[model samples]
Target: MAAPEQTPAQYVPIGGDREISDRIEAYLAKRDGVDKLLKISRYASKIIIASSLFESQPLNSKLKSFESSVGVTRKALRLGKFLQSFNALKKSSELKSKRDFMASIASGGEGLYYFVEQFVWLSKAGLIDGKHSSRFSKIGAWCEFVGYVGSISVKWMDLSEIGEEKERLRSESDENVRELKMMELEEKEMMKRLSIVQDWADWLMAFADVRDGKGPLTSPLLLSSAGLLSALISAHKIWVSCKA
Candidate 1:
């Protein structure tokens, strides 16, 4: 019997004169499998994926602290790159989209991180599972993964670029014929902006959903008290239109 033929990995093209783009392309060019594909974009190795984040580890002078959740920083380029690549994969034919390769495994709504983690995790580590050795190694691996990836995965985005929607209206009084007529005419426009604002809110909730412990409102954004559903409501309630 003959061995299965090697399918060549497609070149991942990233544009920009920046060094990070060059670095990402270089990582993609050498890698062949899903495991290699995913790790290339992680901002830090010790990022919490499998376990409940609320189950916190003691503050360690020895081991590194946990990484921030998404939206915690604009510099989380590894995650940004992984998501960006997922978008790019949609447009190309020659490159095997990660979805194609990972179709057998499921997301379980874990998104891109789950796929990357399956690739980066070690099978041998399973041998030590539930043992003291495993705990030590897990901590060490987190440190090493973050240290190894370095600045290649870091990129910054302006907050405005991250789905900003300017507020429009409902603040206008329904008084008289003309004001009411204008509000009626502009209701759809107001709804559209409201929808955009809601999308950001929905995303925040999803981020909260995937991680354990605090709700999105209380977590990265440090919004207090409000839980996910309430945050969703408040996102809509707070955005009354300013008259131009």
Candidate 2:
């Protein structure tokens, strides 16, 4: 059998300085995003191993406490990155033009999809199944939280007033009225998205509450780690029981 040729990833040009691929790369390389995500995945795997040892000697208590701290830190880190990236994308001049904005959106959406896929892989390897692990539950919760925020952000971005004005420019008899209306609608949408982004950013910061050491009764990170560990332990127990 002949080997099939692999297609290269398509790159879209943005402006004179930035290409769509460059922006996507930059976004992924963001310290507040990728670094934290990797750390979270690493810790999540550790939690699974730790959970398995909980039945043994002195390791159980220490692992339990450490798991909580790791979980909180992960949640805080994710929330911070999500807010920063969302705001940057929303405010970019490149995103102001409909065509340019859509390109950026596609880049961002694809990047997030890739991140989530990696997350699922890590979960499976770490034995963080939702049915048996708290860590998996936490991961699922964080996913839902991110989804909610992303949905609202998209809705705000696709404001109808702005869309209508863009359409109006094509056929209106008077150029002056058309231009004025476009400006007004654009400004309104910008202000609305800006306000919503600000509020969401604030909420994420509160969720993390790095300084206070408190936020939700249990941090998402902690719950996720604990869940992952529990799942691994349960699976291990099941295997031992079957062998016995």
Best by TM-score: 2
Instruction: For candidate 2, list the clashing residue pairs, or say none.
Output: 71-221, 71-222, 133-227, 134-227, 135-224, 135-227, 135-228
lDDT of each: 0.34, 0.49
Least lDDT summed over 10 consecutive residues: which range in candidate 2? 235-244
Query: Cα miss at 40, model 2 (Å)?
Result: 4.7
Please, what is the TM-score per model? Answer: 0.20, 0.26
Per-residue CA lDDT of model 2 for 107-150, tens digit only, reads 35433533443454445346456344444444444543454355
Worst 10 residues of 1 by lDDT: 150-159
Model 2 RMSD, rounded to 1 decimal: 18.2
lDDT of 2 at 229: 44
Question: Model 1, 36-123: lDDT tens per residue?
Answer: 2232222222323222333545532112322322212212223334454445435443436443323212121222442343333322
Off by over 4 Å in 1: 1-181, 213-244
Q: Residue 241's C-alpha lDDT in candidate 1?
A: 28
